[model samples]
Target: MKTQLEELQTQLTKAKQYGTDQETLNKNLLRILKERANAERGIIPKKQHHGYIILCSQQLIKKDNIKYSEAVTAWKTQIQTPYPLNLKSSEIKDQIFKDFVEKNIFIEMEICTDSLDIKTECEVNLQQYLFRANTRTGYWEIELYTTGEITIPLNMQQPKKNATGSCSTFQKDSIKSNVR
Candidate 1:
């Protein structure tokens, strides 16, 4: 009777605290299970981040002959696009929250201070139940469990060097922007 009562209490507790979309809940549950397995194996799990973006080359070249490296050869005319440290979009936040709940899908991301460092390999996991979005200020705060950053050699030179911390400036560069 005590075990049955305890089980019922656990279910009730879960019901009361769950506020995320149903899909994300499923993902969290799965994550918990996996974490438990890792704990048993004595392998400390590393963290992934809440968000990250990828910039691919824009120019595409057609290939006359197919080869093993043909796919990459197509994008010869391309600039190295840097990743956005933190994206502030309602659409992205919504998508991430939903994806996390349903699939526990965590996108790769780097922290703001270490964007230029090539050695910084960042992975992201949305910290459960800490997502927040403020539209007025364009601030989207989401707690992410992450593997801490490390100093790495700067390989890819960034065209746009943002201020060290999150800045509120929109200073134009000497070169005119292509934006309309």
Candidate 2:
């Protein structure tokens, strides 16, 4: 199991470096490895799991008449992962705020509560597009002019109007990207 984990780690590194779609498969393999580790440590033993790579490779080699070497080298390349985000939390907030101001994204938030009724409306800037506050669904949404929209749910079915709302915190190491 340790050797398998090492091999999967190597594959994951290669996939990331080569910008291959195999990264997802490598990640899944890593997750399976973690589960196996947990089971070995006397955690709940999950049902046996197997990846379909072996069957797919076999089919490609036999049915498609492809060489084993060809099947092994079939790593579909994709866009490389973006550079890591290393900005501080304050820096991230500043950058996001700058983007909002630059994009001219209008933000409006309201909160009202009574003995029996609680209602909130919130709009945050996302992707320099049209923003909407869905008070009924308790989600702040940003609809792109193109096709889809990005919806961020409010915590506990309520939107908090503050410097930082109910969204996840932007830690220095964990933040992946800025507004872009």
Among all candidates shown, the one with the greatest lDDT: 1
Highest TM-score among the candidates is held by which one?
1
TM-score of 1: 0.20
lDDT by residue (31-143, candidate 2, tens digit) is: 56535533332233332321100000000012232334443111110110001123233433443334334432212112111221224442321222222333332223332
CA lDDT for candidate 1: 0.33
Q: List candidate 2 segments past 4 Å from native.
A: 1-20, 45-180
Q: What's the lDDT for candidate 2? A: 0.28
Q: Cα deviation in Å at residue 148, candidate 2?
A: 41
lDDT of each: 0.33, 0.28
- In model 1, what are the clashing residue pairs, if there are any? 23-101, 23-102, 24-101, 24-102, 48-123, 48-124, 48-125, 49-123, 49-124, 49-125
List TM-score per model, in order.
Answer: 0.20, 0.16
The root-mean-square deviation over C-alpha atoms between each candidate and the true structure, in angstroms, is 18.7, 26.0
Model 1 alpha-carbon drift over 4 Å, by segment: 1-94, 98-107, 110-129, 133-137, 147-180
Q: What local lDDT score does residue 84 receive in model 1, on the 0 to 100 scale? A: 22
